[model samples]
Target: MGVCLVLIVLAWNVVRLWSTTAAVVMSVVAAVLPPIAAVVANWGEDH
Candidate 1:
């Protein structure tokens, strides 16, 4: 979560100006992180 937010903030505020493609890729990676985190968090849990 924290990492995701940081990535997004950097992507928009810093990386975008230098390279839109890199920024978009970072944003996409940030977007995917939460759900992956959720799945990892729940993995092997008993519900």
Candidate 2:
């Protein structure tokens, strides 16, 4: 759900910027951080 929201926002920005470079930067940020946080959160939860 959160990822979807981020994707929508990135899509909106991509429309404005319309550059592959900008999209890649946005995608990298969107792609990387959440999984890291999710793993940490899940590990803490399991303990």
Best by TM-score: 1
Give per-residue CA lDDT, model 1, range 1-47, as digits (tens).
89999999999999999999999999999999999999998998995
**Model 1 steric clash pairs:** none
User: Residue 44 in candidate 2 has what lDDT?
Assistant: 66
Model 1 deviation from native, Cα RMSD in Å: 1.5
Candidate 2, superposed: residue stretches over 4 Å from native: 1-4, 12-17, 42-47
TM-score of 2: 0.45
Q: What is the C-alpha lDDT of each candidate?
A: 0.96, 0.68
When summed lDDT is taken over every stretch of 10 residues in candidate 2, the lowest stretch is 7-16
